[model samples]
Target: MKYQTKIIEKPADTLTPVGVYLRIRDQFPESLLLESSDYNSDKNSFTFIVAGLLENFKIDKGVLSVNHQKKSIENTETVKNALKDFIAQIHVRQPDKTKQFNGLYGYTGFEAVKYFEDIRFESKPQKDAIPELNYGFYRFIVAINHFNDNMIILENIPDGETSQIESFKNLVTAQKVPQFHFKANNDETS
Candidate 1:
């Protein structure tokens, strides 16, 4: 699988992990920022920040949505099968191990632990329930090397993609994120 790599180096004085995250967080939900504050770390030392979704995986109340292509999965085996099929179908470019930092990055909730352990739950749906699992796959990431004080914008476009997509420069140097002010209509010490 072929993928495009974009490396953008800028002076550390001008750009920072927090600054970059602040600039792009509003543009995309689930914008991730991971920092390894330990100085002079090894090959694992990279601050990764990425927004926007190349694909999304979510399972809510037994309904699975892979990039908004939904399926009702009634059992764990079915859900596992759907995920295997959907995940395999989504990515055209596999991670190139030769690259410095490239692979699947995501978080899994503890419910998955129960599932793997064959544990059952006496669970009830709550208001504004979160998904059992929610994850996203990205095509690009802004990786900052703490040791070198340099930033590399890695854009991994699938080999099959030919259409135009947003660039790292545009994303990083774009307009300021909109700000919002919220006020409580009634104030009480409840």
Candidate 2:
């Protein structure tokens, strides 16, 4: 699938999955973000979660193997890897220490094309007020934690067409992210 990479940085408090999703929505303006489970959910059961989409990618974190003692780390690394592509879209000050620094893997992908065919009201034919959705990934995603306090940084990894890349740049430049302390990789950063 085609993909776009970015670095997404936010205050540790604001770096939740939902926050990441909202930020991407605000930035991309025309992308459908869905999680792996959501992707599998029935049409009537479809629900949106900020982090759901990112979790679908299941990006590799390069950890040797999953261990029961490191379940949290395993989960974090999974999500972190998922967000790696998302993080590659930002620029920040040098980190004093780093954790989960899977640089360059931060990316979002087009999973499926959605078709908002048509809907009918009770009796009368309803005008298709809803916009037709055909382009973009139906399930592009990124990662975030609801209650993380450690400082994190992600640099934007440029991919996709020049216009697409420039558009993302414009969005980032338009609104500056809240400043947070930078740190190098450490086991506790996630």
Please, what is the whole-model Cα lDDT of each candidate in the order they appear? 0.66, 0.32
Per-residue alpha-carbon lDDT of model 2 for 43-91, expressed as tens digits?
3222222211211222122221121122222343444453454345334
Query: Residue-wise lDDT of candidate 1 within 1-190, one digit each (tens)?
Result: 3455444455454677877887878766678888877757766667888766677777766567888988776566766786677667654443353266655556667665543356787766677677778777676677777777776666657666743334556667555645679788877764
Candidate 1 stretches with Cα past 4 Å from truth are 1-6, 9-13, 37-40, 90-100, 158-167, 173-179, 182-190
Q: State every prediction's TM-score relative to the real structure.
A: 0.72, 0.25
CA lDDT, candidate 1, residue 103: 52
Q: Per-residue lDDT for 160 in model 2?
A: 40
lDDT score of model 2?
Answer: 0.32
After superposing candidate 2 on the true structure, give the runs of residues whose Cα lies further than 4 Å from its correct spot.
1-123, 131-135, 138-143, 149-190
